[model samples]
Target chain A: MNAKDVPHQGSFRSSLYLFIILMIIWLVLTNSLKTEELLSGLIISLLLTHFLSANYRELGLPRLRLKRAANFIAYVFVLLSEIIKANFDVAYRVLHPKMPIRPGIIIIKTSLKQDIAKVILANSITLTPGTFTLDIKDDALLIHWINVKSEEEGEAAKRISERFEKYLKVVFE
Target chain B: MKKGVSIILLLILLWGVVAALSEMPFGKAKLEVAGHYTDYGKEDTGAANIVTSVVLGYRGFDTLGEVTVLFLACIGLAVVLSTLKKQGCGARQTPSLILNTGFRFLFPLILLFGTYVFMHGHLSPGGGFQGGAVIASGFVLMYLSVPKIKRLNHFVSTLFESVGGLIFLVIGLIGLKLGSQYFLNNFLPNGEFNTLLSAGIIPVIYIAIGFKVGSELSKIIDVLLEESE
Candidate 1:
C-alpha cells in the first residue's frame, strides 16, 4: 500500500521511526541502554528528522542485482588494490628526488545512467588514488590526475569507467 | 504514479530493512564498516568513546560538513524570516508559575551538564553534537518560558558558527602540514583519561562544535518561530 494511505504516515510517525532507528544505532555504538543514551539518541533522532524530512524521498536505496552486485564488489576490490598501488606509487614519486608530478585534468565518459549510481561512480573515482573527480557533465567525469604516464588519457578513462560503470548500470540502474 | 514518490517509498523500505538487519548478530561487521569513525577510534586513535573520536577527530571533515549544513540552514531561515514582519512576537501570557520556575531552576544545571558532556567526551559517550543539542534545549526552554526575552543573539550565533567552522578547517590543514596524515591525533596530548583536560584536541574541538551547534539551532528555532507567527 502507498504510505499516504496508511495511518500515522506524517512527520510525527516519521519522527518516531527515526527515533527508534537512532536509538538502535546508539545502542549498537555504545553497547549500552542507559537513560542518558536513550535521551541522547532521541535528541539526535529529532534533529535528523527535522533536517531530513524535507529530503525523505531519498531515504531508502534499493539493493543491486546479485550478479551485478557481485561484479560491483569485485570491481571495488580491484579498485582498492589499484588505489593502494597508486598511493604507494604516488608516495614513491613524491618522496623520490625526481618528484614526478605532471598534474593535469582529463575528461572521461561513463556508462552509468541513474543519478545515484553516477554519483557513486564519481565519488569512487575521487576516492581512488591520484585522480580527483572535479566535475561531472553529460555522462563524462572531469578528473584531475596528479600524474599522467601515458599520452592516451581517454584510454585510462575508458578502461577505468568500463571496469565498474558497466556493472554499476546493471546493479544500480 | 510519480517516479519521485515511488523512489521515496523504496528508500523508506530500504531503511526499514537495513535498520532491522543491523540489529542481528551478523550486524557487527556492518557496524564496524559503517562506523568508520569508530573503527579509527578503536584501532588507531585510542579514544574510549568511538563516537566522540569520530565526531571530534577522525572523519572530522564530515562533522565539519554537518556543522556547515547547520549554518546554511540557519542562514536560509534568517533570509526567509527577514522578509516577514514579526507578528504575535511576544508571549501571550506570563508563563505558568510552574514552567517559569522549573525552567529557571533547570536551565543552569542543564547548561552545566551539557558542558560536562563536551569536556569529557573522549573518556565517555557524549560529545559536541550531543552536548550542543542539550544546551540548545535549555535555551528552548527559556524561550518557551519567557517569550519576550531574546534568548540568543543572531550575530553572536553566526560568529560562533563561523569561528568554530574555521577552527575545524585550520586543524585539518595543520594535520596535512605536520606529515602525520590528515586529521592526525597527538597533535595535542591524549591527556589524563577521566579529566576534563584529557583526550588531546578532542575537548577543544568539542567545545567549538558545541558553540557552533548551539548557535545554529537557536537561530533555526528563532526563524521557525517567526515563520509560524
Candidate 2:
C-alpha cells in the first residue's frame, strides 16, 4: 500500500523532508563546527517526529469555501472599523465621570459550523475593547461587556454575531 | 487496555489534524501578528535573538507568566509526589561494567556541552530553556545508569528555582528603579554585539533560568525514577 493510504502515519517522504528542514535550521542557528550540536539537533529532530508522524485522521476539516473569502475580507474590514469606533467610545466613557459600567456577561450563540470559524468569532469579540471572552460552551460565547446601551441580551447577541459570523460560516465551516 | 490505548491514539490523531490544519493559510493567518520584523526588531527592548527579545523583553509580562507555569508544574509535581510517600529505586544494583564506564566518561563532556550551549545562547539561537533541557538530560542519563546517585535534593532544587525566580524579578525591578522602563536593556552596560558579555542582563538572566530549569528537571527525573523503583 502507498504510505498516504495508511491513514495514520503520514508519508515517509514528508517526514524526511521535515527532518531535513529542521536539521538545516538547527545547523544555521547554532553555527557549530563541533559534532555535539549536530548530535543534539538530531535528537531534537527525533523528538519532533511524534508531531509529524500524524496524518490528520480525525477532526476532518471541510473543503475551503472560496466564495466566502471575499465576504471574510469585507467582514474583517468592518470588524476593524468597529473596533476603532468602539475604542474611542470606550475612551470617552473612561474619561467621563459616570464611569458608566453596565458590566455584564453577554452570551452569543453563533451559527458558524466549523470549529475554526467559531474560534475566530470568539477571538474577534474579545479583541474589541470593553469585551472579554469569558467562556465558550456549545457554540455559544460568553463575553463580558464593560457597557450596555440595551439590557436586552438577545438583541445584543444578534448584533454582535451578525457582524462576524456571516462571513465566518463561508470561510471555515 | 486496548480500548484505552485506542482512545489515546484517537486523541493524538485529532490533535494531528488540528496541528496540520493550523499550518495552512487560514490557520497561519490566525497565528500571524501584524508587524514587520525589522521595525519590531529595531525597537525591541533588549537582546539580539529576536525570539528571546520578544519573550523576555517586549513581552516581559508574558515571560513572567511562562515562569509561573513552570513554577506551577514544579509545585504540582512536589504536591503529587509528596502524597505518594514512596521511596526511590536507590537500592537497585548499579549497572555493571559497560554502561557505568560509558556514563562516567561521557557525563562531564555532556555537562560541558550543556554549559557551552547555555553560555552561547545569546550569540546563537539556543537560550536558557533549550540549553537547560540538554543539561537535565545529561543528569537523567546518570540517574538511569547509576541507581545509587543521590536523588537531586528537594530543598536544593526548591532553593535554585525560588532564587532564580527572585533574581529574575529583582533584575526587572532594578531596571524599572533605575528609570529604565520595565525589562529595559542597557540597564546593565550592553557589551559588544557578538561577545559572550554583550547582552547585559540577558546572559545573567539566562544563567538564572538555566539553574532553575536544570534543577527543576533533575528533580522531576529523580522523583519519577524513585517512584518507578
Candidate 3:
C-alpha cells in the first residue's frame, strides 16, 4: 500500500473514504434510521470530512481488493485464535501451583515498512498470552516474553511475528 | 514533617468546607423549578433529554461562565508554563513507532466521536462539556503518540475558542431580541419531539461550547507538553 500512488491532495476519494467510515460509526452508535438522525449525521460527517482539506495527508486506508480483504479477514481470525490459545496458556500457568515460566525481554525485527502494520502486529503480540510489546524502535519491537523459547532474534521473530506477518505483508505491502 | 502538616491543613479545610455545604439543603432547594423542569421540561424546552433542557435551557448563562472560566484557565496555564521552560524545550526520546503511526488513524476517529457526542447532546447522555473534554483527550492522545507533531497553531486555537464563545453569546442576544426579554431564551422553534433539530438553541450552544472547551483544553495540553519537553 504505497500512499504516494494514491492521489491524496484535495481528493474527494479521501473525503468519501472518511465519510463512509464516519457514517458507519454514526449509524452504529446512534442505531437510528429516522430521517432527522440520518440528515443530521450526513451534515455533520460531511462537515467534519472537510477537515481532510488539512493534513490527514497520509490517511493510510488500505486499498480494497477481494483478495486483500479476504487476507484481512483471515488475519483477524488468526489473531483471535492466537489470543484464545494464549489465554488458555495463561490460564494453565495460573492454575498450576509451580508456575512454569521464563520471563525476558527480546528484541525482534520486522520486515514491515508501514507504521500502521507494525502497530497492528505489536497489538497482536501484546494480546497473545506470553509476549507483551514493551516498545518499538523503527522496525524492531521489544517484546517481553513469559517463556523465552529462543534467544536468537531471527528465531524469536519467526516464533512471534512470522505467523501474523505473512498475512499482514500480503495485505499491507 | 511538611507532609504531616499539609495533611492536617487539608483535613481542617475539608471539614470547614463540608460543614458549610452540609446546611445548603442539597438537591432540594429548587423543588418548584425542578418539578416544572422535570414534568414539563420536554414540552417547554423541546428536548427529550431533561438534563439538556436544564443545562442549555435554564442554566445557559452558567454554562457560558463555565466555558469562560476554562478558557481563562487555558490562557493562565500557557502564560505560567511558558515562563517555567528553561530556554528552548529540551529533547526527549521519540515515541514508539506504533504510537507515532497509530495516532494519525485514531485522531480523526476520536474527533468524530467527540463531534458526535456534542452534536447529539440534546438526545444523548453526554453534553458539551463531556464531549469537549473527549475532544481534548484526542489531542492529548496525539501528543503522547507523535513526538514530532508540530505545535498547535495558537492563532487558530484562540480563534476557535473565541468564536465558540461569541456564538454562544450571539445566540443569547438573538434569543433576547426575538423571544422572551431574558438572556439565553429558547427563541427559535423547537423543530419536533426527540429529533436532531429539536431542542431549539440547545444543540447550537452546546456545539459552540464543545469547540470552545475542546480548543481551550487542547491549548492547555500543548502548553503542558511544551513545558515538560
Candidate 4:
C-alpha cells in the first residue's frame, strides 16, 4: 500500500527529528560551521525532512529504540563472525581434492512479517557459506545450498534462518 | 572457421594493446599538461583537487556539452520507451518482506552517501556524475524491491532537472557579467584553499550538475520501470 493512503500522527515532531539528524550529518560531512554552510544546510535539511517525514509517518515506519538499536549492532557482529566461519568452510571444501558438494535448491519458509527482517534473513543466509538465496515467493525463500544436509523443508529452514531471524524479529518487528 | 576468425581478432587486439603500452612506459611521468595542472591549478582555480579544476575550470564548456549530450540521451530513452505497450501495475508480484525491508533501510543511507559524494566533489575523487549515478541506483533498488509504492513523482524530477540546468546557465551568465567576459568564470571570492566553502562557482556548478543528472537518470529509470509494470 502507498504511504499516502495510511493514517498517521505527530508528523511535525517526526519531521523535526529527521531535520536534526540530517543537519548533524550535514555538519559532519561539510566539516564547517560557516554561516552560509549552516544556513543552506538548515534550509535543505528542513525541506528534506518535511518531505521525507510525511512519507515516513504515513508508512508507519518502525521506531528504533535504543535497546533494539544496540541489539541490531550486536546482531551485525554475530553475522560477521558467521560469515567468516562460512568463508573458512568454503575454502576448506574447495581445497579438498574430492569436491564434496551436493548442490540443490531448497524451498524454506520464514515467519518474518516485516519485509526488512525477511530481507535481512535472506541476505544473512546468502552471506553465510554454501547457501545462496535465489528468490522469495510469499513466505518461502528459494535457496541454493552447496550441500543439502536434509530433505525436510522445515529442518532446512530451521538450520538456515533460525539463528538470524530471532535477532531480526527483535530489531525490526 | 569462426573459431579461427575469433582467435585472429583476439591476437590483433592483443598486438594493438601491446604496441600502445610500449609507447607509454609504465610508472613514468608523461603529458606536459598534467604537470602544468598540478603546479598551477590550485593558484589559478583555487580548487584543491586538480582534477576538478581541470574538468570544471579549464574545460567547463566541454563538460556542459557533455551534460547536454547526457540530457539528450535521457530524452531519447524516454521517446523510445514511450512507444512500448505499458504493463499494468497488477502484473507485478509483491516483493518478499526481506527485500522491501532492506530497501527501505538502505534508501536514506544511499541518499546521504550520494549527497556527501557530490558535496565533497571539489575536494575528493567523486563528483556530480558519480554521485548522480549513485542516487539513481538507489531509486532503481527501490523500484525493484517496492513495486507497490507510488512511482517517483514525475513533476518533481522534471522540475529539479530544469531548475538545475537553469541554475548552471544563470551562474555562467553571471560569470560573464561580473568576471572576465568569459562564461563560467570565477565570479565570487575563491575562499581559502582545502575548505568546503572554497572554490567559487565550482561547488555550485557541481551541485547543480548533481541535481540535474540525478533527476534525469531517476526519471529514465522511472519510465523504464513503469513501462515494464
Candidate 5:
C-alpha cells in the first residue's frame, strides 16, 4: 500500500472487514456467548467500526492470507530466538574481563516502506543486545550499536535489518 | 546550596519513611475494615473482586467524587492550554515506516485490552480507572508515533464524556427512585457470582466511568500535545 492508495473515505468493504475483526475481538474479550453479550458486542462493534474505518482509511491494513499469517507467526519465533541469542551475546560481552565492546552510532537505511514493518524491524534490532534505535529520519535510522561490526551504511543496514525486513516485507506488503 | 538542601530533604523523607515502615508489621492483615470488606464484600455486592465491590459498590459516591476531581483537572488543563498562542507548524520529521505500522497494529489490541479490563471490573483485578488510563496511554502512543494523523474529534469525545456522566447520574437516580434511598444502591438483581452479568449496577456504572474517564483523559492529552505543537 502506498500513500496514493489510501482512501479519503472508508469503503464499504473495508468497513465490513473492520466490523468482522472487531466483532471477533469482542467475542474473545467477553469470553461469552450469552444473548445479551452478543447483542451488545454487535452494537458496539458496529459503531466502533463505522467510526474507526473512516479514521483508519490512511492506515491501509494489509490483506493477510492464511499462508502469510502463518509465515508471520513463524517470523515471531525467529525474532524471539534472535533476541535470546542477542541476550547471550550481551551477557558474554559484559562478563568478559576484557569487555570487548566498541560502541558507536551508525546510519542505516531500510527498504521496508510500511510503517509497521519498519517499526518491527527497528524494535527487533533494538531488542537484540548489540543495537538500539536512537532516531528515525525518513528511510534512515540512527542506531547505537554496542559493538559496531561494520562502518559502511549498506553493509550495516544489510546486517541489522535484512533478516527481519525480508520476512516483514512478506507479512506486511 | 540547592543541591545540599534537596539532599537533606531527601534524607529526612527517607528517614521518615523508614521510621514509619519499622512500626508496621509485615505479612499481617491489620485493618478491621479490610477484613470486614473481604469477608462480606462478595455477599454484599455480588462482585468477585472485593476491591471492585468497595470502589464501585460500597464507596461509589467517593468514586464519583474522585471522577469529578479528574474531570475538573482535565477541564483546568484545557482552560489553561486554550489560552496559549498556537504555534506555527514546527519542522516535525515524518516518522519512519516502522513506528507508524507498529502503532497502527498495536492500537486496536490496546483498545481491546482496555475494554476487557473495564468490562471485567466486577470479576477481576482491573477496573474503570485503570482501563481508562490504559486507553489514554494508547492515545498518547498515537500522538507520539503518528503525529500527522487526524485528531480525535473534540465534539464526539465531549459527547461521550457527558453521556457517560449522565448515565452514571441517571443510574444513581434510578437507585433512589427504587427506594434504596442511597445514591448508586444495588437495585437490580445481583446475579450469580463470577458471571459478567452479575453484580447489579456495578458493571454498568463502571462502564460509564470507563468511557467518561477515557474520553476526558484523551482530551487532556490532545490539549497538551496541541499546545506543544
Candidate 6:
C-alpha cells in the first residue's frame, strides 16, 4: 500500500522525531537559550507533536546508516560539480554568437525502484542546467532537453540521470 | 505527573506574557511615546518604525541567527521530506486559464510588493521575514498555476540563500570588529530620518534577509510540492 493509505498509527519514534524537530525550530526562531524560551519551546513542541503525530505515518522517515550517509554526502558533491559545470555550459551557449542549440522532449528510463529516489533523480536532472523533468510515469521520466544529443532512451538516461541515480540507489534503498 | 508538568509550564508561559503586557501603556493620557521619543532623539537608528529598529538595528544579531535558522530549517525539511519523495505518482491537476493568467501577472506583482515591503522596511511595518514570505508565495503560485515551470533549480536557490546569509554575517563580523562594540553596529552614516535612504545598515540587512528567506522558503515549498506532482 502507498504511504498515504497507511492508518494514523503514530508511533513513539515518529512522535519523538516530530517533537525534536519542532523544539529545534523553536530554538532557532527564538534565537534564545534562555530558560523562558526553552520552557515555552518545550511545551509548544510537545503540544504540536501530540496533535500532529497522527499524520506522521505519511512522513515515512528513513532508516539511516553510516555508509548510506557517506554515499549521500558524496552524491551532494557530485551534484554540486555537475551543477557548476552545467552553469558554465549554459553560459557558453547563451554567450555564443550563433546560439546554436537543438531542444526536444525525450523519454528516459530509470533503474530506481523507490519513489523518493526517482523524484530526487528527476529534481537533480532539473537542477543540472541543460535538462528539465516534464513528467515521471512508472520508471520512465519525460525530460525536456535543451540540446537533445540522442533520441534513444538509454543514451539519454545515461547522459542525464546515470550519475545521480548511482548514489541515490545506494543512499535511499 | 504529565498534568503537573503541563500546568507548571503553562504558568511559566503565562507569567512571562503577563510580565511583558503589564509594561504596555494601554490607556495612559501622557504616553511614553510622546515624552521619551523627543528624548530618544530623532529615531536612534534613523528608522521610523521601532520594530524595524529592533529587527535590523538594535538586535540584528538575533535577526542574523533567525535567518540562518530559517535557512537550516528549509535544508532539514528538504532532507527529511526527500526521503519520502514520491512525485507524479498521483493524478495531475490541470490549472484553469484564469489561474494561469493570474499566476503570470500576479507572481511578478507579488515579487514587486515583497521588494517594496523590504525596501520600505525601515519606514513601515513590513520587513525581511514578511517580504521573503511574500516572495515565496509567488513561487507557490507559479507552481500551482503554471505547469511549465516544473521545479526550481536547487543550486540557484542555495546559492542565493547562502550568499545572502553570508553578506549578513560578514557585515555583522565587520561591525563587531571595526565599528562600535555592538553586535552588528557599523560606522556607516545614518541618512535622513523618515526617508527611503535612512537606516544605514537596516535597509541593506533587510534586503539580504529578503533574498535569503525568500529563496530558502521557496526551496522548502518546492520540496513539498515535488510530491504533489
Can you give the lDDT of residue A107 in candidate 2?
77
What docking grade does candidate 2 earn? Answer: incorrect
DockQ for candidate 5, C-alpha atoms: 0.38
Residue A135, candidate 1: Cα error in Å is 61
**iRMS values in order, in angstroms?**
18.7, 18.6, 2.2, 3.4, 3.1, 13.1
Q: Which regions in candidate 5 have their CA more than 4 angstroms from the true location?
A: A1-44, A54-62, A135-139, B1-26, B85-91, B146-150
Which of candidates 2 and 6 reaches a greater TM-score? 6
DockQ scores for all predicted structures:
0.01, 0.01, 0.55, 0.33, 0.38, 0.01
Worst 10 residues of 3 chain B by lDDT: B81-90
In terms of lDDT, the poorest run of 10 residues in model 4 chain A is A53-62
Give the C-alpha lDDT of model 1: 0.66
Task: Give the winner by DockQ: 2 or 6.
Answer: 6
TM-scores for candidates 1 onward, in order: 0.49, 0.48, 0.85, 0.82, 0.84, 0.50
Ten contiguous residues with the weakest lDDT in model 2 chain A: A52-61
Model 1 C-alpha RMSD vs. true structure (Å) is 24.0
RMSD of each: 24.0, 22.7, 3.8, 4.0, 3.7, 21.7
Model 5: CAPRI class: acceptable
Candidate 1 chain B minimal-lDDT segment of 10 residues:
B96-105
When summed lDDT is taken over every stretch of 10 residues in candidate 4 chain B, the lowest stretch is: B96-105
- The lDDT of model 5 is 0.82
Task: For candidate 4, list the clashing residue pairs, or say none.
Answer: A115-B97, A116-B101, A118-B98, A119-B98
lDDT of 3 by residue, B168-212 (tens): 999989878885688888888898888778888999888998988
Q: How accurate is candidate 6 locally (lDDT)?
A: 0.75
Q: What residue runs in model 4 are displaced by over 4 Å at the alpha carbon?
A: A1-46, A54-66, A107-111, A135-139, B1-27, B81-90, B148-150, B226-229
TM-score, model 3 to reference: 0.85
By DockQ thresholds, what CAPRI class is model 3? Answer: medium
TM-score for candidate 2, please give it: 0.48
Per-residue lDDT tens digits of candidate 1, residues A16-130? 5444555565556555565655566566556655644422223222342578668778878877886787789789988999898998877787775544466667767777778
